[model samples]
Target: MSRPLDKAGWQAMADTLTARLETRAYIDDRFVDAAGGETFETINPATGEVLARVASCDQADAELAVAHARRAFDGGEWSRLAPTRRKRVLLRLAELMEAHRDELALLDTLDMGKPITSALGDMAGAIGAMRHQAESIDKLYGEVAPTGEEALALVLREPIGVVASIVPWNFPMMMTAWKIAPALAAGNSVILKPSEKSPLSALRLAALAQEAGLPRGVLQVLPGFGHTVGKALALSMDVDCLAFTGSTAVGKQLMQYAGQSNLKRVYLECGGKSPNLVFADCRNLAQVAHHAAEAIFHNQGEVCIAGSRLLVENSVREAFIEHLLAAAESMQPGDPLDPSSFMGAIVDATQHRRILDFIRQGQEEGGRLRAGGEALDGPGLFIQPTVFDGVTEDMTIGREEIFGPVLSVFGFDSEEQAIALANDSVYGLAAGVWSQDVDRIMRVSRRLQSGQVFVNNWAGGDQSVPFGGVKQSGNGRDKSHHSLAEYTELKSVWIALN
Candidate 1:
């Protein structure tokens, strides 16, 4: 069913919306200035307008946040809080988020220029994930090993020290909650560094967290650039673990920083050039095509798991391509504030131009554009949902992640060839299978070298499933019980009896 775009609902959002949010870097549950008196422009890509003058947090602000987090974790006020108490605090935070969701989501759209619809989903997903963690917080436990004769071995699940969670611009609020909820539930104090492009929600959340009765410094948000606050979090000796979601290049730098600084646990959810494989055995090619368009078109294809590369069998290639183009043509890139808008603006002008550069390069490299290949003329940074046919494997558009509403189509003759083509990319983040045959689903899921594989649908996760990729896609899991372990340490206790 289509979501209702009612006038009342639209009017409510319009009245609440603002181009800028009043916030500051959160330290010890209080808003403060960056020691460095610097600032940056947070722009609205939907209209290329400056939304807010955000603090340019430098090394000093980073140090302050880390110190506060270290104090909170080491003080044991938060880390030693009983699981039920932690759960109560989490539940309270969830309620607060719901209460202010419209405000938070609207501020996010204004700053990042994501559609209000997308922002609402971000807010809902963040609240849902927090509730999920609240319910499961009590399930945490340590395991007792079986004894042969002498004694028993107890494996205690203990909270690690201060944690640094760095989120990307896309889905900032949801990603922030994804890391914080599990890490906090596992009994660790956290320092959050949201992307400067969209840090308003993170700061706003920090205030709500304080109101939720979370002890001072239990959760801190540092609104700053990657070179300063982000780098400090990654390189701080006091930070026991670091979590990040961004490009592979930054992920690699985090890996190196972890090794160089404290050898801290680095959890990363990086980029992708995932395959959405369409076998000839599929009956509904049109439905499959429409869903594929949705996969890339959603969030302007800023999703880490966008099915960017479409692998179609040669037999039904032409018909599927026709349907895919039709789906793209139907999409409208209107104002992000409008509730009726589907495709929204790119997150920022840099990203807008980056996606456009890739499109132009795709054309120059002989890839055929069946749909869109240019940015629409207007005040907003809007690009039409794009599709390229006859894309060679070597082309930059096919191999590298464009991270926009762009899809590369390559036809395959046999099952072996399809698998080979899908696995050819350096990234193994996510993939989808569209086939009626169960055997094909089983075969492809096993052979596909991705962290998550979606069969007959686009969704591929629950809160329990580990959500990290292999190879260049970055390491460590985000969701599931496994994710909680990333922010914890296991201490071995042995008794000496003589």
Candidate 2:
């Protein structure tokens, strides 16, 4: 394990972030105030301190930004630029991100309470996502359909004008990259609304994008609450699309906002209660146990695709529980700035309390607390890496998305039973099946109802994978070439040439 940054080093990083806050939101390639100079203070969850005062942009500011984006799109300087030119700007943005990786990682850690090591990796992931989309632009080709000799049919993809991206706070920088990269690559104007809880990095990213030669008004950042600014974007008639990543309820509301306004295309990547199934034939129980614990405890279990529900065959239930508990004990929550910390503080006091409420609900409903269930004795917003065994299918913990460091264990007798339990959810975002038997892995993987499945592993994939969910988990996908389609519209044109 690597040593954590010392106190002085952390303080220096904090000072740098504070200086960034002096000029909060980035709109139209400039650091500016909200419409009325309204501002909000974003707190650091790890230290319970004020990290920065960000612009509290609302409907008026959102409208202004949307107008800017609409004008940029209509002007055609950015939206109609050659693919190579757009690609160059995007590559430069990625380069700038790499150059400031350390500062960006530190900003993420202080803003969202993620471990410093994990945050550094997230910065790299963001850079990669940007580069992937940038490099893909020039390779995308239109198609010519086979028509009779008298006629020719062409299928071309065109940008959908102004795109609004409303992202969550859990993976702020990465989520920003996911939406911004594809939208900009497709030659659309973008307005980014970062969650008020963690807006520092997005603000910094907008500034870097401008420095990379993105035309003014082509990309903007609005730092505000979802209910106010998010609603405005969804309700804007001039906006052509809205891409969101958040809760199912909010995603639904955004869809309605689109309907009420211009009927804009809305793409959502929402909630999940993904399952991790372990059969009795698994080759190694210890390795499975270790990864199983990580599937839930990593990122403090704030991931939308976290393996919150663990299903084990009855024959190996006891052994699996033993090893899992041992693994869970090692993932104690610590200071997020520590490079060696496995888990960090919860996002804020509200989220910390919400997780505690779910923990209480788990106990009151009937699940037995096998490992951790209490808050730590500290000033920062911290919670234990909680695990519950003997959890029933109907228990609150088993059915709901806790979005915290809590795991619920259940037992299954047969393959059919495991598949049934896994599919019985409002979400079908992802699932994992662990077994050494190749046939069994294939059989179970085929039966699992999820967008992504992992066999003999958990949460393993790259930016190339098409990621999204089914049922109530929301619609559309993010990442990969598939995501680029979300920001573009297909048109079929037929011409008769004599």
Candidate 3:
């Protein structure tokens, strides 16, 4: 279908989808009920309506899915397929996803409360990532190591079997693609445990994968609470590797579970308290302020690499705040299905309450509320774009990952102080530097402890480069050839020549 022209058009399409939503776990090339036949309600955060009662999978389901995945991996049906053959499968899957772009976008919007427009962008990103990884399958070359004249050596990259990808509710389709695309392209059987809050798109994607010529038992989708399905995947001896994108606390738990289990490899892309610095030397304060608001308010601030902290040089602090407040005014939360709505509802009531609590804590801790710090009057879980000025490095809102549409503004007298404030947090997933001075941008960008740094920009990068973080933001990269390495093992071979 073409892009919906108006809110009514989108809502009508969403109503059509609601009547026949997929609600079962997809395993072994089919949809089935949970082992215990239990179910859980997935709420539409925008209107507080139950979209579906999806299969509430648990440890038993995880075990079943893993067993299927292991069987498929060892059977040489997909794992031993030629790289070009795997490439064709992935390319076909991408085509299928493109064909159903509107449905997938609506599913994520209805499930997780992201704006329809943003969800469409996510579909494009997901499809692009799939195609990129597919094309890379045959292009990635193994190495022929140098040796003496009497000997020959070869190094090969082999797929790690049975990858479990546990993704977050925010940006569900894109995050799922980031993990499963690379793993599947690397010839691994994948058991995907999408967050229960947003599993419709993933469950639907599994069927498309099967239709795209993926072998039976090669791809499975199990949706449930983290304590059950997630824990099981992390602790499963049959699972060769686990890749996750979520909170730091959960990432640490998975690490501990890895140690307690069969020592499977774990790759995490977790939480962030990213800092955005605006030096006075920046040529365009107005543009910087607009992007600064977008960095935190877009997607209702559910981004893992959201620039939650804004550090400004004292010289232009007041001027920047004026432009930033104006930008925030244009980003008020609205119905997610509305194409004009840039910001949508919070993911759920629990997250809504957590964001409110942090806002309250920010006031209690003496940070001045410069702009909206209250919830919008609506049936949905929506909050105004909140900005806290006078934030110090010691403030709770400044140090912690709020993961909401909240921006903490801090002022620094010197470049040294700005760098110090930016690096003062336990999380360092991403950061932004705004400066026209080439030397200063170079200096600050190198000194900041972050996985990705955007200079004169905010949150700008593509799948060609790696996406990940250091410190508590979690280790391991995603979305590039580096991500493919995570799902593969290196094998070195030496041959004697007569």
The lDDT per prediction is 0.85, 0.91, 0.94
Q: Tell me the tens digit of each residue's lDDT in model 1 across 18-42.
A: 4336557888878887778778888
lDDT of 3 by residue, 178-271 (tens): 9999999999999999998999999999989989999999999999999999999999999999999999999999999999999999999999
Mind giving the per-residue lDDT tens digits that candidate 2 earns over 56-110? 9999999999998898999999999998999999999999999888788888889
lDDT of 3: 0.94
Identify the candidate with maximal lDDT: 3
**C-alpha RMSD values across all candidates:** 2.1, 1.7, 0.9
| lDDT agreement of model 2 with the native | 0.91
Q: Give the candidate order by descending lDDT.
A: 3, 2, 1
Poorest 10 consecutive residues by lDDT, candidate 2: 16-25
Off by over 4 Å in 2: 1-8
Model 1: per-residue Cα lDDT at residue 28: 84
Sliding window of 10 residues with minimal summed lDDT for model 3: 1-10
